[model samples]
Target: MTSGKAALLIAALGLSACQSVSQFADPLAPDIVREAGLGEQILNSGDPNGAVRYFERAAAATPDDVAMQRSLAIANMRAGDLRAAERAMDAVLASDAATPQDRVERGFIAVRLDDWERAGAMTAALPPDLDTARRALLEALVADRARDWSAADAAYARALAGAENKAAALNNWGVSRLARGDASAAIATFERALATDPKLFAAKNNLAIARAMRGDYALPDGVESDRERAVLQHNMALVAQRKGDAAEARRLLERAIAAHPQHYRAAVEQLAALEN
Candidate 1:
């Protein structure tokens, strides 16, 4: 059988006994259970190293336990151990006790690994509804990476409508709109994201682009308070060019590059625009 077929077969077989496998010896010894609780706190606190040790001990005691395995997998991924993460995912998928959520998370790892074909195939098999929304988001990410603009736009819109302000979803959704020449709508979406989180670098950078497209020199109100305002000013120059004011745009671009010597794209484009 092909890899895709093999993966599907594995998914089908593993899903059959998910409940039973998850019931494997609960690694809930009083001390260990306390550790497990603390691990969750650490995970929530974004301390992957602390969480990993707790999860590792929990998995060791409940070797075949699906929940422990899932925790282990997530901790490993957070700790940047991709190989260990894949191994945990394999164990989770091989058991008859894996949940639909397990399969979805496996698909997530595949996407992070840039295994788009596998992500597409695995997500295609997920149950619809909430699962479908998650899959749609992943497909949007894959499509964005692959430069399939139309599919990406549709997928992201679906995901955003279902889960508002999901940072990655929102950022990519705006990207798809920008890709398709829907600058106004893209700008709106990007700005909404900025409002949701003032310090999100990707949203800030993207919002700058959208503002530049509209021929505006303003940074997203207060974003420049913390971030380098040179980027915002540089983007404004591009907006000037877009609005057919090449001279003003060139001057602004030159000023930006002078202020920040690393603004290579702005400098090159401004010089080229001047020549033309």
Candidate 2:
């Protein structure tokens, strides 16, 4: 899937997901806050682009409003506009009113941006007392990047322990297991994550990936949308490609296009890439 709809969400916890524009009290213009609030509602409704429109209005009205900027940053991230998020988050961090959550948000963005060094810096600078689960998850991701598997495992444990959202932590752990080439273990972990939170999209998507890695090409049980199915098929095709099963990858991409209700350009493109 594209980054906006999702990315297997192996990283990028989407820290600001379904959260209010600002965790702190809103002392700014009510109009800006209300506009941002509408953006948050729209974001939660799965229209990041629509959310961005509302957030951009808020930002334009009060460019210096840190709270508004916070919402804008997350809105842009959800919209798959990391460059916009980067600028907004950087401005947020530069302000005296910035909070630890803002820094952590930046760290996730950095990870998505493939700037592991910057992400690590933000992770290292994070305070120990705030949102331990997210902090530990960040540490785990950075550790995994450094090839420090032991550190990653330990941090994932801590993340699960303090996780306000246990399914998310478990899902990430499952992805980490997949990264380690433990498909069986990853499947079990993903199953556990799903059992804990049946609606966790990443767990469902990752479970399909795990199964595909284990040589199962069937779609997972709960993916109801054709678009989602197409996305999952594309992901499985990538897994097949990675395993050098070009034939299987091509077949899956073909299946992806067939399953899609409309033009699945991504699947078509992947098919082209695989064939060529």
Candidate 3:
């Protein structure tokens, strides 16, 4: 199947399994609530364009519904219509009908827009219990981007304490440490992150880079068993190329691309680097 078809199938399967799609009616139920629920169903079923139309209708029919607005914003974001997402979020923010959940959802949207300050402000409005691990992760990213390393570390520490995003927290914390000239500590932290979540692609990717930086080429322990083994092998080949073994690099790269034909970036880049 085509990648898009596969993605749509997965989306449809996921929606079919979700209680949120089947059990939860729109907050207002009946009237616009029913329409909103149908819209969300369509969105979850991988038809973002159709979902947007329904959500737009629901939002217009009930302008006071912060929930519908939030859903519309999320649909827009998923459809890669950033401008529409921004408009929907703005509409939600302008509405006095917003609940804490709305604020939190808006915070998430702000993070996607790279408006860290706005995200922080919206997150501040969320209740403590509702201020989730995701919110903390966004705060950490914002702090890290702004060069507030201490705050970033603290936020990541808090986020990981919840145990939901342990891998991401550890990986980002390692980056914070690396920025501070602590290569060994960064490596150790990344290793710990990998141990905590073996399937975390970002952690694995960063770990490889960190190891390469230290002139260490050993593969991380879990790669052989990973679903991303092909990608990992490709990364290893790139690393070999960097270490001046063009012949072995080309061989490994070819092996990886053979394993996963969709793996293009690594194969293409390594091929160019070797030929040059």
Candidate 4:
């Protein structure tokens, strides 16, 4: 898969920008909560590195605060500091007051770290009644990672049944199919995701990837933020690269990086590789 495609798949499965400190019910010091709230705002504003600085201070002030630790972990993850995220998540998980969501986040971190054993164990231990959709989705992810397509499919079906955001489940299911080398099924799945929620930019980008993998040049159409448009352009560039149009690929990648300097790290890396 192209770098852009790989990045999109990772983004789809990873912690999203919409995640809030409010999701956790853990009681926190007022000072720590205020600091963590500022960190979350920074994270949502597209500056994970900046968010990490604030979150770290909050976590340091309240060493035993699970909520601060969780915020720090997410900020570090967003900043692409997996080791920092792992440490923070471990702290959260070790806390006696860790919430169910905390466990789920730890499982997610394990998945990102490719610690399949821990991921499976953590997710498997989740309360079946709490956040059923998330549990099912995580189970599907683990099944997909194990290359158990049948199990993945079953889990994905359950996820769809319980999900409040069916579009996200559909997009993830399509990504699983794509990983299994079923471009046709993946394309159809992405289409269904888009039909379910037209504003799902990730699904639109994934649709472009599936089509490109099938040797189609047509780009997916949608209205999006400048960053999202950059991502779409990066995906098209990947398609061009795969088609042996190196010049066009280079142009598009460069354009994508220029369009969103703060985001699109994969595009920057790809452009650098092309130059080298």
Candidate 5:
């Protein structure tokens, strides 16, 4: 039996040829088509490493195919191969078939590559009305990196105004505040983020970090994952240490390590230090 990905690929290929298999004239050979389909499935499943391997093979077989190149570029970006992604996106932009999404992704790639000039150029070329929230967030990040606090603040406000998920923007805003040494504002922003989305782990983590920075120890509410709970416990342990309670700190660290063995490396190290 064909897998779901394979079946989807076959259907897409059939549609491309505008006929059933017996009379179909697919532009790509069966093997290449199958690989591309599997690659897309892997990408959708969030396994960019696996997707990259399959996409690389399909791209090698169909170098002139813009869609395949775009897939390869996205897979590479997800897999943290920014240089390869940039090259592939450059090829896509050079083609006549590049879309607005392509430009947005390429602009993000330029941001990740720290090519600020290129990123600005790409952002400038984007259609003004497209993906306003995402564009604003990206611009905010770029401005933050450049230490343009005023620009970052304005862009972040725009992001929050238009974003569907305000938790991310709030968390990032907290981070920016923390970077600027406003611990009180950062803590409040992180709390607001948690109130907006209790399941936002980044916000939870930032909240823990902000509390730790202020020598305050309190367990975060509404955390659902053992790993996140462990992180919170670890942060509490740090608070204990800051308060000169070595025994309590050790206990908290041990509890953190017990809560999530896979995510308690810092707790383990801290426990060992306390013991020593």
Candidate 6:
């Protein structure tokens, strides 16, 4: 794929951002309790967009409430509204009640935003003696962003040292390996991640990508949409081309064009370029 297409493919895969939220419980607060509780319920039901309105109301009712703001931030992040998440997190961190975990959360948001400096600053703002898996996850992410492979690997090792949920960090590390052109390592890392958490869809999809990089192109079962199939085929075509298998690339591109619901301009253009 062209760099633009590659970037879009990675973005669409939704692999970059990863975080956890505590299970929602009843709040003792009177004014915003109902709103916040409803928001968490909606969010837990996997309706982040639906949760946002309730979270907004709760945050509005108690502007400086750190827990409410944290909930809102998580909801916004889950909904892919990074800007809104940043705003909500800023509110949380500004409050006196912000915890060390909140600082790491803020740093993670910064990493997702590609704000490396702010991410580093957030990491620095945390208590120097604080050692947690989330903090190490942020460090790995920052190192990955900086293309410091050794540092990233070390940080990821630290992140997974004793963390019960090793899948997410392993997935991130696999992505970094893919970025570094280590398809074999990436495949192994993704497999490890999936072994840790069979429910991690990102690891499964990424494993497919890694396999395709080696010219073993096969679409995952989870890719259902016509457009999604087309995108995968187009990406696999690019991978084949990079591996010097022009014929395989052409075949995959043809399949992509056939699979698309509408005129698939990118695949068509790639095919034309290959023909030339």
TM-scores for candidates 1 onward, in order: 0.62, 0.73, 0.65, 0.67, 0.71, 0.72
Candidate 1 least-lDDT 10 residues: 17-26
**TM-score result, candidate 3:** 0.65
lDDT of 2 by residue, 209-267 (tens): 77876679888777878887888888888777766799999999998999893767888
Model 5 scores what on Cα lDDT? 0.69
Error of 5 at 91 (Å): 1.8
Off by over 4 Å in 4: 1-47, 223-237, 240-276
lDDT of 5 by residue, 1-276 (tens): 123332332233221111111121111122222334634566666677888898889889989988888888877877778889899889989999887667766777777676878877877787877756667766776776677878989988997887777887777777766666677887898899889888877678767766755666666788787887787787767655755778878888888899998766988887998899
Ranking of models by lDDT: 2, 4, 6, 5, 3, 1
Name model 3 segments beyond 4 Å from true. 1-54, 100-104, 116-131, 178-181, 224-227, 236-255, 258-266
> Which window of ten consecutive residues has the lowest lDDT sum in model 2?
18-27
For model 4, the run of ten residues with the poorest summed lDDT: 18-27
Give per-residue CA lDDT, model 4, range 1-276, as digits (tens). Answer: 543554454444333211111122211112222333634466566677888998899889988777888888877876778779889978887889776666666666677677889989888787867746666777888998788989999989998897767888888888788877777888899899889999987688878767766667465767467788677777777766756788878988888888898977988987888789
Clashes of each: 5, 0, 0, 0, 0, 0
Which 10-residue window of candidate 3 scores lowest in summed lDDT? 18-27
Q: Tens-digit lDDT track for model 6 on 196-254?
A: 87766666667767787666888765565777678778777876776678999899999
- After the best TM-score superposition of candidate 2, give how far the Cα of residue 17 lies from its true spot, in angstroms: 22
In model 3, the Cα lDDT at residue 200 comes to 66
Cand. 3 Cα-lDDT: 0.61
- Which residue pairs show backbone clashes in model 1? 17-96, 17-97, 18-96, 18-97, 18-98
The deviation in Å at residue 5 for candidate 3 is: 41
Stretches off by above 4 angstroms in model 2 are 1-46, 225-230, 241-258, 265-276
lDDT (Cα) of model 1: 0.61
Residue 272 in candidate 1, Cα distance off native in Å = 20
Better of 5 and 6 by lDDT: 6
Sort every candidate by TM-score, greatest first. 2, 6, 5, 4, 3, 1
* Model 1 RMSD in angstroms: 12.6
